[model samples]
Target: MVRRRLGDAGPGGRGAGRSGGGYDEAQAQAGAVLRGERKPTNPLTAGQVHVAFKCHNGKHIKAESNEELRASSSVIKEPEKFEVEHSGSESIYLKSHTGKYLTVDKNGDVHASGVSASDGSVFQVLLQENGLVALRSHCGFVAAEANGRIRANRSLIGSWELFQVKDRSRRSRTEHPGHELPEPDEQDDAPAFFDAFCQVEGILTAEERYAKTHHDRTAVLFDKRVRSRRRDHMEWSFKHFYMEKEYPPSFRGCVSAWDITRVEMDADGESDTPKAEDTEDAVRPRTRSGSDGSQVVSFDGLEAGRCHWKKILQEDLTDAVRIIAAFGVPAASAADADEAAWQRLLAAQAGCKQKTAHVLVMCSSGLCKAIGPIGVDCSPWPPALDAVFAERFAGLGAGSIRLKFGALPGEAYDVDKDPVFLAWKRAAGPTARGEDWVLQHADSRLAEFEAARSDYERRRLSEQVSTAKKQLEMAREHGLPVILQLPAQDDAERCMAELLVAVFGEASQHPILLSGFNGRPKCAAAFLRSFPGMMVGFNGLLTHSKHKQSLGEVAFDVPLDRFVLESLGPQYPPADSAAGSARGSYSHPAHVLLVAEELARVKQRLPRDILRAAFSNTAKLFNLSI
Candidate 1:
């Protein structure tokens, strides 16, 4: 019943909605431009254009290094660009800037790993009345999750599934001519490198010629801006001083160190591609492989001649400490000295929470005399306290801290006045440890419930109180220091903290430590206010590429005396770091040092100073002798 037009040939036509069209109209126009046959003056509106998909939430669809397509909320000005290659009137293939095609998996996950456009990569573009578009794969509609993940799993279209197609070619066509725009692979051409280098070279004086030479060798930029614009080094005034010729933002914070061994890169060639055997200890440039057999390079934060403080470059602090302990080997065999560093880091992370009848603290002695010890176990839960609390205070009061826990038949006790409760209270007092008692949470279940506080919230609270009471009893019985090991999540553990304050009274000092804190800036201030005498623990999690920027912000406010180091297991390790061959051969207790060094790197302090302060805090907390 449909009338046919010159261009309107249904699904098989080039421009189904317009007159005078061909399926290869877009391809022909692109080819003509590449062949220097014509100018792309308003080419985007004429046919298929390179575009970027911006979700309603303002995030842009990006291709991760693993080729997984996700919605990224990064603050960078540029998002990943994709070219629209039309298959039919309604179907198209989204080709990434790297030449790979976006394909949908059997599970409906989108990935930019396909080399050529195939049936899996063909997506039907459904235009909506609101000017947005929905991409339909074989399985379902492509959806953008609130967490910045992209998938094609939903059968129905929703707000999350709709994306605003941004014409990247539109801006380029009008403002920048085709020849004027640099090719993607030529972003870091010689002219750009020289421009950046000359700016640094102009600031150097005759006396600083050595620094100038060093800068020339190591100061290479793979991209225009720093890898992480928010990196601590980027914020350093010295960086601004050298690059922008400006004074530091503050004079008091401007401390400098020379004779530091920087992370060395082989300056043999202009290529910035990373070597095959780059070790974890090296601060070399990072590289990603492109689908077209080219490499894209980036620097994580190592820019030379910025006057960085002494970093633990050759060996992690723990490895260096261990090497010094082995009677000090010559520089030749030093590489073999700290072979077990990786194992130690693994052990420290895996055994972070050691369940034992007693808590023990060990101290290390060597060249780095204060390199803190491993195997500091928090006291385990006692069976007796559970029995006692169930018998005395479980079900007597309504919000009474009694009825919520549900006690046995006809059981009640004045918890404040009870002999057992009073005894535990005495043992929990600051005077028991000759300094201050700590109350740590050992339960992992509370964090799950913290996300959703249901009818069982009161029950969980009562249970936490009983555990704290029991832990105090055990610490008192064995003459152990009661350090409050709180969960990294503040909301769930905040209740436990408030309960302790309510029961024990905030007047008594209880030193607290967040065991697995991942250096979230929002959670840092809240933790400081909620727990008295609180200390933040720096762990391996903070060393991740994603958390690199946040770590500096979190570490800036923490007092040197109030921060401790932990080798907590990494929640997400990179693909290479997780390989069985790369397991224990990598960072060890040095993992703790790496965290400290990162803190120090951000705070602009010497690595040794950070290590000493952390070790001192550790010793004071556990009441251990140096």
Candidate 2:
């Protein structure tokens, strides 16, 4: 049986009586003293707040406000875990201020929200959304916890300069200059709220998806390897958009495994019927990602981990190593050299003294290949190079120097004992790659903001239509339907009502591709309202961790299978730029496989199905779960 042990305290001191004298009785006595039974003292060192009088009858009273008493506890509580319901536009403002855990109903004080009081304070939870869990300290996310910070991940903490490449020689031919890529063009007229963002993100994600589907073969072959080995050692290096996601410059998030599920439906291959016409096969149940390498597949059900992997790295290597070890996993290597370097790293971690605990150097096949070939004990990677480099530095009586490597691969192989290097050894997980991680959410007056944008869009669209119809000498196309397709995975429905306006749509008719917020000054809602009675939109799904993929992403409670169907309606897809035959399209396994593998590894290390559920809730609130 699973051992359910309470951590010292329970609600109102309910469980403590099991040990020794009743802790409840002691607390009642303490409460009496707190109430005013005993004599008052100056103050007791509880935490920060002062405790005054010690009354008789065991009541230990503290003269703090009733509010403080209501919230007081020895442990710190997280506010994000608190679930509030959104009945509608009317209910978002109606969140209960009582913050009570139970409601008086036919169920007899059943769970009001998912949150339950624990240890007088702390709230152990499963996430219900993706935004910052605003706390007294600052804003942060639970995903940051894996990186040695139990606290929240700070919002947009770093400046652009922090990402400057240190060495020019080590740069990849594809992205050596590290120049800025042009943000997608935004129309002067844009929509409001997430509507505009959805349009913009939809275009971008569609473009990227096109690259994957069309250019995948080319991207796989001649995939320029990002990191290289110099002479007898490894050279850890990278540049923007280098060979792949695992290269230090990757925009991927900090993902964990077990966050994606892989299913197998009946329609993966052609039917056995030899004479069947229109021989289209049925769709199969698979993981979120479609890889050329079929052997490394997993059927677990994690879907929202894509949000985690694409998250930035907060902690450095040393702390990262500690976190890996905490989960009983070994250190991940950049290349084969990491295997031998593991011993040196272990010794160094122990101050170069006799090593106590043994650590295994695990690396993915993608990463191993990056460091070139490997023998029984020799290679030219960071870990292997570090061992030699450390020795060289020590021999020269130089000061201690830290060896840094770029993004580490997501795979691992135990270079020590029983030889372990199987397919997807540590792969098979969900990931959140390709999305912005920082954005200041407009708070406090969100409702007002929504109202303002809607009004603005209405007036603007009315004028545009009035003027356009006069100029073209065309009659107002009354009762015409307008379609604004959000990215494929994005919920265009919520923002649909907001963007229904007649304008020069795609094909000059039918469904129009309303240019969403492509870094444009105008908002999406206002742009839509400018053209009153008209249906205009194109379909394209902005694929990413849904949260930071702009407002174009939609949310659904169902898995990827069901969520994808909504995008198939009348919508304009992104133009594929990487389309062609599968010849020169093939790239080396460098950035291509490395990225997928890294994404896979990162995905494999996270919590799966639960994360997706939380992601859905967030989508609903953001108006993306249409």
Candidate 3:
């Protein structure tokens, strides 16, 4: 029910009229110039004269021997002249001295052909500030030259569309009162190409050419100003520069968190001491003097290994200040280095003047690697370590002890293929307690297996169901908060649901943490609904991609309690000393500092109770307390 505007120009002037039926403002201005109502401000005289259209590439549009116009670099002494006559419409027709009108054929080629005005012969002239003009044909093709040949085919106005219209009638300038021509300077005649071209053939110097090529003057000036300010800020003396020692000097007197698992091997070539299980009364603390005169404390019962904590403390920390010493123990091991490390840490905690520092011992089933492939090796923790630490730490009189257990593959029920299942099977043997436990929970699946169609399929399904039940029982025995490292795959949602069902029977609201999920909304949302207290860990590298404008600019609509920043070490490239040599190699100090700064900025928007940062062994080597 709407009427179309007759004067509206279609895109690219597809169906526009030659005069004014559907001409835009630019075309209307061109019409006025062509009709002589408005004279061009350029010095070019309006009269019949031999004119040459020069392109930025030093080529001139000239009529060939066959009367076809082509762009040529070769200079010609005399060219055919044409009469500039207005067509009384939105364009002008060029009449050659030989009396043929300049027209375009069906192929968009320029040549003097028809004796009368036609749509193909009509051209709208656009004037530029640099005394250059562009001719657009009625069919919306701008006259342009490519590879030294003139063609009416370009659809956009660019460097190639510009042409230098020179008046060839310089000898008759005195006869025309208003057309006073000035002497031409070589530099003034240079065309503004402003892009890379055949520079060797051009007359401009490198500096002059660069100025024209970089047309954005404001950007260039701003960059120079920034560099100048940066130079002023970098005026530092020799005292400001210091080499990085093995440990920062400032940390010598300050209370610092140390991961004993990262301590280097002693001069005696022993990486770990003899297993603590071999000796009775292992809870007694023993001290030995190192070659550097520092006292090394070792504990057998708590599995805390040798630590140099005493040498590093100038004065005991205040009662309110606590230094955390954290390490993890695997489930299958009767003796583990992390266990010895924790015992040593706790023994040291008992001797301190103030009960300020504490020890955090993480115990996990030897299934860390079975969950999925990760950049770093996932150390396994013995299930016994969880029970032992949970029972022992309850009565510690010194600094408190925090116990954490790693959850076995919550839903990795592929019995034959899953490492956790295979390990449990081997440990339990044919007549072990695990076999009885598996049968008790997998009765329904075992009944189905007895009536399955294929023997191979039945065996696989039966083993998987058995493994699922065994894993569920393992989760129940811990009776503590568990960390669930989910597989890094798109189907994590289904895996999570299956794991929850296997562990809790239905969906008991037990506190669980899910790791290894990329910060995708759908994956996060799936965990949010099913597990109310579920903590989802995302790779810290996601911050780089999500907020490109600045560091710490990322925001998520998900609750803070459900979000966790994890895998800080693997995100950084290895130190230059071991570049490309290992996956999850040690991180450089600068890399850790950069991540710490970013996390500090991002933490402002997160909830106070949110579990802020998680680190790998390599990242743990860096000072994370800052």
On TM-score, the leading prediction is 1
**lDDT score for residue 411 of model 2:** 16
User: What are the per-residue Cα lDDT tens digits for candidate 3 across 16-60?
Assistant: 233543224333554465666764564233553456566654345
Model 1 Cα lDDT, one tens digit per residue, 121-147: 988888765456888899899998765
- Residue 603's lDDT within candidate 2 is 23
Winning candidate number (lDDT): 1
Rank all candidate structures by their TM-score, best first, as comma-separated numbers. 1, 3, 2
Candidate 2 lDDT (Cα, whole model)?
A: 0.21
Please give each candidate's TM-score. Answer: 0.27, 0.16, 0.26
User: What is the alpha-carbon lDDT of model 1 when measured against the actual structure?
Assistant: 0.42
Candidate 3 lDDT score relative to the true structure: 0.37
Looking at candidate 3, the ten consecutive residues that score lowest on lDDT are: 192-201
Regions of candidate 2 where Cα sits further than 4 Å from its true position: 1-296, 303-626
Between the candidate structures 1 and 2, which one is better when assessed by lDDT?
1
Kindly list the per-residue Cα lDDT of model 2 for residues 255-319, writing each as its tens digit: 11111111111133111211212111311112222111122221211111122221111223331
